[model samples]
Target: MTDQAHHETTAPASVLIVDDSRVSGRKLAKAVTALGHRTELVSGGTEALGILGEMPFDIVLLDIVMPEMDGYAVLIAMKADVALREIPVIVVSSLDDEIESVARSIELGAEDFLPKNFEPAILRARMNASLARKRFRDRELDYLRDIDTLTEAAQVIEGGAFHPTELNLASVAARDDPLGRLAKIFRSLAEEIYDRERRADLTVRTLRGTLLVIAAGSIFGIAPALGRLASAREIPPLGLAFWSAVVAAILCLSFSIGRSGLPRLKLRDLRFLTLWALLLGCLYQLLTVVIAAHVEASLIAMIGSSRGFMVFLLAALLALERPSLQRFSGLGLGFAAVAVVLLVQGTGEDNDLLWIACALVLPFLLSLHTLLMSWRPRHLGAATTVGIMMALSALFLLPFAVAQNALFLPSLSFGQRELITLALGASTAAALVLALDLVVTAGPVFSSQMAYSQTLAGIAWGMLLLGERLSPLAWGALVFVIAGFWLVKPKRAGDDFRITLRMKGNG
Candidate 1:
């Protein structure tokens, strides 16, 4: 080794030590620290797994003879994990069949083996080599991902952008390495997306477009209505969302089973599914419930009705949705409506700002979910995707509900109003999500216009049930919301068919 590298020490990487022996763990950790790396110590294999689930380490040093789950079992579990598999593991044990143990651990994906009384120099050398190998592997993976994204970009140029997917974005100007090649790729994608938008509209169509739009609308419409109901009943937002998400998950799973046979779950699949659920299912859903309980019905109606405009704007910025005059005009109308509502409402409650922030964040997260949906593996049917998200979301929310004493509050005590409200909310939530999947499947654009239903329902329920009144300005905003929907209503089918007929005539 060069004197500079030897003198400078290895880069500080995190290491996880799984050993039952306090003396062994402390000695190894001290050696790791002397080599300028961070160390974490866990007593057994199961504890190691739980800690790894919460955070990642650059390398794991596992002992094989521990009770219950030993080094071999832990090695298998790590290899089965999508996120952790890339992290190299080194087994540390002293057994009669040391040679056989080393071979088995390697097969289970361990990078190296160490003796219980390992020499300090050899341990540092092996760890450094493993870290180097990991970095090389990462670069190769990044290259493949960039190339795959480029292929998708080519498909857009060929006019197959009905369900355009967005590429992951990063500011590339700061980097001056091979990874910088991705910057040019990003610029090329943006240019291609812009060119396509200038050429012609890409329509996703079905004869049932209008019906799907209304169905999606009605399903989403119930959210605001139910929020107001929860406010009246003094029920907590967490409970309302938890049960509703549980029911929605069940309904979606049934639909998915009807479409695709039971899925064989893979490590990567579970990882991705959990991520999606955390964002839309738990974070977004919980926030929406809270926002609904706090905000005025008129304000909620105005914002809720603007979902289409939000989706359109989000997709356009990501270069996934086309930028057209009608869509732009629709966005303008939606913004104008929001402004009018703001002027009329004038932040009636001290916490209206908080409500608006929560409402805006919910749709932002949902828009992100919609964009990413197209990128998921095609074999994971839409119903299955939706089902996984709802189910995981329910699981995420359960602990919070239990902590708040919201779960089964009405069910156990038989508070008729709360029980009925819970039932209505859960049933509507399930039906709404199922309908939403179908709508987005056929046409993302039309499905987005479900905002109109949400807006109208927000107003209707607030008025008829709550006896709420709207200011003249708020009323004017309502007009803008209606007008925006009129401008961007679902397009007639057969536009593509007409083009084909024209080509035939020319021929």
Candidate 2:
């Protein structure tokens, strides 16, 4: 009681302290009040929720190991509620080594976690930090709101004055002199909107490329680690499960593509389209899996090879369309970068030459698919295209999968492993292919740029997670890829000539 009285004398702050024990709750309330903060004491999560509804509080001090309504449940409820979600929650628990509890609390949107027996100073510091974060979030939200308002106003102005046809004609007749000025203003507003939209589109494109690259890199890194786990029998069920997942993912991707509604294909589609192109895109993964099963080529290398082919095909297709020097340079740099990485990190003893050959051939097939998809105006939507392709690919590969005994669904002793594998394969792979299809459909340059990004991401993920080392040559390769991508950025005529002159001057 004396300790509580001594503490209630700082700048007034509102805190809701929740604990099952009445004595402990009172102790916390008194201590919090001593720090010049008003404290609300609640016995459990249910009461805390009720109190939260009655009035706003600065922070909630939650107890993790509670009764019916545990701290986790309370935290989740808080996060789910738009009105209560922003309130800072500090979890005060007796359990010192509750890593899962702490992780879960944080994930459920808890602001901070503190040991129940923490020092007064530590408690104060944690509270302050949480409050600071809340303030920062508030400011960010405010900024976003203001920006949204401005964007809306700009859009409305750009959209022009809304008038009925009858009124519009009357106004035009009455205000002939002002009509030109109005038109000019409207045009200016429209131009600004267009510029803003274009910038946004470019940013989205760049972000999409970055995300895909990261995903590809991550998948590559995971493949080797998962393979190693499988070999060790540490997670054989998981490995087998992942194999199933990969098949399912391929099937989903095939479905997406077939349903994508590509322009009506005629006999002429085959003339322009080589079987190699389809094989390249489609068979690479099949080859990758076979090699991964009995070879030493790193997953990263395979992913890079696939990406390289995809980019090469895109560049070639683009060059065919536009016949640009820049496009050719991008293609060369992309391949050279891939080569450098491969050369520096020589193939492992387990790496079969045939497998590598198969992997190399894969991109051509993928490129063919991309090129055909991009050849004309899309007849099918993105979702349909991805679905159809995935479905078709699955059908085409079904016989092979069946023959190899890889498609068997044995009774699982490990449901969790099976689910994880399914999620990784179906969700992750399907999402990636869908995104890639969208990027490729947008433009060849966009697709190629994404490949470079993916390679870098893969390298990063490998180094961080899988203890994969990048050689000096590999580093150089990365630099070349980045530089090449920059060099290939679309330029106006004046900029192109200027760049050419500078190159000549350097030479």
> Total clashes, candidate 2?
41
What does the lDDT come to for candidate 2? Answer: 0.56
Candidate 1, position 279, lDDT: 80
Cα-based TM-score, every candidate: 0.49, 0.44
**lDDT agreement with native, every candidate:** 0.68, 0.56
lDDT of 2 by residue, 354-466 (tens): 66665554345445544555553244444444444434445555565566555645345856445434543554354445444545533555454445544555455446645
Q: Which window of ten consecutive residues has the lowest lDDT sum in model 1?
A: 494-503
lDDT of 1 by residue, 131-221 (tens): 7777667667776776666566444435433322233334342345655566566556565655454333323343354455556555555
TM for candidate 2 is 0.44
- lDDT at 381, model 1: 66
Give the Å error, residue 130, model 2. Answer: 86
- Residue 279 CA error for candidate 1 (Å)? 1.9
- What lDDT is reached at residue 505 by model 1? 33
Off by over 4 Å in 2: 1-200, 220-282, 299-323, 327-338, 352-354, 372-388, 403-406, 415-424, 427-434, 437-442, 456-469, 472-507
